[model samples]
Target: MVRVAERLDAVAAGLAEQEGPEAHAALADRTIEALRALRDEAGAADWTAAAVPAVRAHAVGALMQVCPLTRYAFARPRGYPGDAGLLDLIYRHPDADGALAEASAAGRAAYAVTSGTAPCAAVRERRRILAGAIDRAAAERPGAAVLAVACGHLREAEISAGLRDGRVGRLLATDQDRESLARVADRADAPAVATRRLSVRDFIAAKATAEAEIGRFDLVYAAGLYDYLDDRIAARLTRKLFGLLRPGGRLLVGNFLTGLREEAYMDAVMDWQLIYRTQAQIRAFAAEISEVDLAGANYWADSAACVGYLELEHA
Candidate 1:
């Protein structure tokens, strides 16, 4: 704890000496590099000497006063890390522009660098890819049915022409947070989208009920959920989602890759944590489903190379 505190103090002291956005941005960049190194070293040692939780909390409190994006994530109105709102901030959704304007000098400096990082850029790309996938599915199967598991705010739907034009027979979205579902429900395109307020656990446990109620889908995908799941749950969820697919349907699952430039900032400042996977590790999850004959299986990363996706298609 003392060592972590010292590191935090060093970062604070360095920032204190800087004035103007340029200086603050430079300081933020350097500080993040140092923090990433410290995090890597601690993880290598199995985190025995790293009081990660304490250090993260302290950093979050300090950054919150200066960084609006970090502050909003730490607040986590959904009572968990990686809420949709946080992603909206990272993606710079139109609504986020107003919030950016209200940021403090330090916050603006932090945002300038953090928001432009590879990870943030990749997140926005991921959303676009998801929308493209939906469009392809709908194009292949007229009036295609789609399912978004643990869908956070379902922002990708906004970019999907299929959903907007009612070509998608139905877009079923499930999330534990009603507030997120409420936002999806309130969208102008609400008529074409259906939402269910249920946690992933409940959906997984009651697969039979879900199958009966929601019916099979042409495209089933999950984003921002597998990162928090362990291997066992991810494998189980994969098998279950596979079962929910119609013949020739596709299942796409996403996970952050091993190297993320903003990882340290996410850990230390936003107190957000995720389980990253390598290409091989992501493929291993797909291998768990031995019962199905996969028509195709492939892995791809976002343009920024910060997020990896495993796509499986049922024959």
Candidate 2:
């Protein structure tokens, strides 16, 4: 949504040179410059220590939508503003370090400080999506176990965190890297959320097996996981997760709206944002499930239909 509009705006801004492969690099550079400032203002708020993901979500969502690249497509874990490195490659790639730096510099510039409450309409919608995902799990399995795939640092999303902690019953958590989740787990006040490393094999497990590892969870969510996989993997992962749902279980996926500009800038349309799903695609996924509920209730004014989640239930 926002991505296409931004490219239009960018082309509008730089009509003369908005063409060729060079367009992506040029747009990337402009986006980098913008994100760096946005992040700096975010840092100044000192919320990174408390509302890390929210802050990131707000800053990044706003930046991504307004810019030419989709947030998730250009997303790098632990914070890259303009491109998601592949799961395994992210860990081994030497470029990972540089990308992190890129996130820092570019993210800061991209975000602008506002005097009022978050102007990005998407943030509140994201929170709602999170709440709904949690609620769906609870509703499906009265006492289904829960897990936190990646809690990140802020540790502020406690309701969801508590659900992951065994404190709420059976729970487990997994992350490609442990440090971030550990930051939440290590807290003296940390809830009893069981924690583990995320693995590719776990993705393909049967419903019972998945529940056995994390307990009988009625819902399996990939809040920020979309950014890590390509369309092939995304579809495959969706199929895998579909198998993990109990007869009536659901799997939820999050997508960023707008700002995947690497290709959209000058008519290139590079849709690399964490496997973005259109309304039609969501309808298709719904058809696969015994029941499907797709909601677009939450969105930043600037976001292009990315702040919603898809619910797929097994018969």
Candidate 3:
């Protein structure tokens, strides 16, 4: 591990010294190959956690800056992981195009690989599914009201037909980041979307007041937030969100599945860590909601099998 860390440090030093985008690109390619080789050689000993020590020890943060996604995470502009901007890069949203355009060749190269990974692809799909769920709920419930917890950038609204056509009478999009809420408010269809700056912690604590303030929603979902929560918090949040749903309303939660292909890279290189859950574990969230009607609850993985989903319907 020490030797590998030393080799990575040498490569990182070279990458840091490279001035032009082309030089950075070349060095990034070489560094990526080296990391991949090292990861493969580590066999299945939880390389993500194992590599963290080396990442810190070798001061390879400079090398990781080559990837825009990793750099944003490592930099923590919002002082946290899975920020709205990071999701833009993952979803390949137009919002991220300017950042991509300004990125160095090395950053772009790393982003190309990062954005094309299985988990990233699954995230894109998850957004689509969530959008579709919104449309379906609107169709079933006239003037349906929807709530998106921790709605970063609320990019899924771009692809939502319900929001586009104004079928969704009201969609409350809330996030802890006021900047993210501002971006969502600035969207072309902002009238149809209401932005709120609320954190899960606040929502969980003020359950009664939150329910009274937001009113009942036909569809409520948390797409990426569950990844940061533990089983206890997730289960409790699940129950709370379920309570906010109107009769016949639905609740959906998404999580990265365990054993994701890019788990190691994301943890060690990008400084992103998720509490990955299996399908069974995800279903357990719904099961814990004993007070709710969970007959319609179901769990499944995205097509890429990199993401798991839990959906519950209130009878």
Candidate 4:
């Protein structure tokens, strides 16, 4: 812990003395490398509870807060760690311009680093993967019905070829956050995308007979929800989502992997914590589901190898 604090102090000092983006980048690199080494040395133990306060109490934490990306995540203005607005910062979406403009020069410099981390890159790739999945499902079955559970802003829909080309029959995006749903509803592709205010609890409680209420989907995905669920809820939700799939349909879920290099910084600075899982652990979520109702299951990592994806095909 002392070593970690010293490293953070050094980073704070460097950032204070530096004036340009290059200097900020160097300091960010130093901070990332230092935290990664400390995290690696600590191995796979849960230290977030102890580390977050210690890190935040340090000057480096205050310095990092200047960065809009870090501040939004730490503040969690939407009452959640990984809200859609924070994601917009990661996507460098035009919507974040206001926040970026309000940030200090150091903050913008920090944004350039935090927004370009490997995990952030993985998030960007996840969006692309989601869009591609929708396109493929639409190609396989024109006017395919799709569902995005815990869909945050549904930004991927903006770039989905299926939605843009009128190939998707309907896209039902459900979230607990009305603000997030409203953002999705405001998209130009509003006709193809429908927004519903639904929580994970509602889906977990959904009965098989109630499938008609929401309708079965050709493609169902929950890219960001699994990170916050425990083993029981994750498995239950897996079964529930799989049950909502039409014949030959696909259910894709993503979770951060155990070895994420940015885990420590995310925990300490951003105050963001995720339930990182191994590929085997992710696949195990389908253990309770009978093979009779399944076509196949596949697992892969994003380009940055920070996020793992499990794709289950319904028979």
Candidate with top lDDT is: 4
Whole-model Cα lDDT per candidate?
A: 0.80, 0.43, 0.80, 0.85
Per-model root-mean-square deviation over C-alphas: 2.5, 13.0, 3.6, 1.8
Q: Could you give candidate 4's per-residue lDDT for residues 118-187 as a string of tens digits?
A: 9998888899999999999999999999999999988898889888899999999999999998888887
The TM-score of predicted model 3 comes to 0.86
Better of 2 and 3 by TM-score: 3
Candidate 3 worst ten-residue window by lDDT: 20-29
Which scores better on lDDT, 1 or 4? 4
Q: Order of all candidates by TM-score, from best down to worst?
A: 4, 1, 3, 2
Q: Write the per-residue lDDT of candidate 2 for residues 1-315, one digit (tens) a residue.
A: 122234335533662455543444444455443433333444424423423333234322343433322332344444532222332122222433443344443332232211011212343444446545665565555556544444343232444543544334444566656665565467424354566766545664446655465554566666556645555556666666665556556566665433333222111111232444555443343333233433222222224444445655555
lDDT of 4 at 198: 84
Score candidate 4 by TM-score against the native: 0.94
Cα lDDT of model 1 by residue, 1-315, tens digit: 236667766766776676677666775676677677767767745443464555665653365446667788767777899888888898888867888888877788878787788877888888999999999998899899899998888999999988877788888898988888898888737466899887767766875875788789999999789999988888888888887888889999999998876687777666788998898888877766764468889898887778889999988
Per model, state how many residue pairs clash.
0, 36, 0, 0
Misplaced by over 4 Å in model 1 are: 1-17, 44-65, 207-209
Model 2 lDDT on a 0 to 1 scale = 0.43
Could you give candidate 3's per-residue lDDT for residues 230-294 as a string of tens digits? 98888888888998888889999998888765665676667788898888888887656775466
Off by over 4 Å in 2: 1-110, 113-124, 139-142, 150-156, 159-167, 188-192, 205-211, 257-275, 283-304
Per the 3 Å backbone cut-off, how many clashing residue pairs does candidate 1 have?
0
The list of candidate 4 runs beyond 4 A from truth reads 1-3, 13-17, 42-46, 188-190
lDDT of 4: 0.85
Q: Give lDDT: candidate 3, residue 299.
A: 80
Compare candidates 1 and 3 on TM-score and give the better one.
1
